[model samples]
Target: MKDTGSAQDAEHEVTMLKVISDLDADLNNVVKFHERVDMSLYDLLEQREWEHHPLHEIRPVAKQGLGVLHTDIKPDNIMFVNMKDQPLRVKLIDFGLAKMASQVELGMEIQPCGYRAPEICLGLPFSKAVDVWGVGCVLAFLYLAQNLFSFKCEYQMVFII
Candidate 1:
């Protein structure tokens, strides 16, 4: 039973990855860079009417070779499900905030509130490193079972900025 569950979980993870990959590819193809302006995920989402308005633009770079930027990669966006008796697998959900990066400009800023990188917080141009930072945070939560940065008040997250 455990073996069966494990197999299913693996299959599910693969499926989710494939979906993300496809979406990333599509986003990459549609978004392109220009001399004057960098296209952000928020712009694409807003243009496509994914939502009435763009949410906080987060990481704008494509990381892990994924074509699109997962600007919002909070723990809630990850879905963990057990397959039979196999180990749990993670599925990235909610692409509503994702964007294509070939269009980002020099002055644009994007990133989540807490998981945001120092460079972004300082209003500097960012890259895939933002996603790497978020990944690190997620890993810490998964493995260490704690937040990457701690604070008494949520607003204190700015200190790390």
Candidate 2:
């Protein structure tokens, strides 16, 4: 039974690796598109095409835009393959809390505690920068092998409120 569990884990790792590789390839394509078109983030934000848009309004942009900004990036949401060696590949999972945004807005509701940025913490509207902040938290966890935020109580309230 133990061996079976190990085998399953190994298979899961392989699957995650493939997913990460595909994600990396997709990101590269997005980067190339940005370079070729010379579209700046500032320009995207100022387009005025998405003001007062719901979170779903930005999904199309995220699908066609410059990167998969996992807004809820966290250690538990990311799976690392072959971590014992160098060049470890990571697969990001769980988009339940993800929101695609081109510009920062005020009064936008988003972010989880610990991984949440100050803007989000302050209840300000967020942009793709929120995802960058989450990624930073994930990286810190990877390097430290521990959680970036250590909340003892009211953790769920943080996400709910």
Candidate 3:
């Protein structure tokens, strides 16, 4: 006989989807559908003028000025914090691939292909400078309104850079 567990799982997923749809439809103005703010830097840059800010705001460095590296520094990971009655601020997030400078080894995979620094792509030892390079790429993307290196593979990204 066929496995009944998968059938039950599919039924459960459908039920969950229906519940979520009902909740989405019943939400009030405070939680209206399609009202989510596009907080990502990539999206915000499309509608607003470029803001001049210090690199320290990105927080690529670790606590106490330790040499920590936010290996993945794409625009999607950066967010704009719009505070009521306060100036707009930026927050860098998604440190899932972060590592200390001393921990990174040669040829270790880190950043996304589009944002990968030259040193990392060349299989050389790297440090926080890689994060700086990533920031530069992101800044170029913001000013140009497109990705500087939109490649599917590291080889293509390095070749273009």
Candidate 2 Cα lDDT to native: 0.46
Task: Flag the better candidate by TM-score, 2 or 3.
Answer: 3
Off by over 4 Å in 3: 1-38, 46-66, 83-88
Per-residue lDDT of candidate 1, residues 72-145 (tens digit):
66555544333234223334555555555675555555556666666665667877667667766655444333
Whole-model lDDT values for every prediction: 0.49, 0.46, 0.61
Candidate 2, 1-161: lDDT as tens digits: 36887676566555434444445534432221112232322222234342332444223223222243445555455433333451223334444443335433577655556677767666765667777676666555444444457433235435543
Error of 1 at 76 (Å): 0.6
Candidate number with greatest TM-score = 3
- The estimated TM-scores of all candidates read 0.52, 0.46, 0.62
TM accuracy, model 2: 0.46
- What's the TM for model 3? 0.62
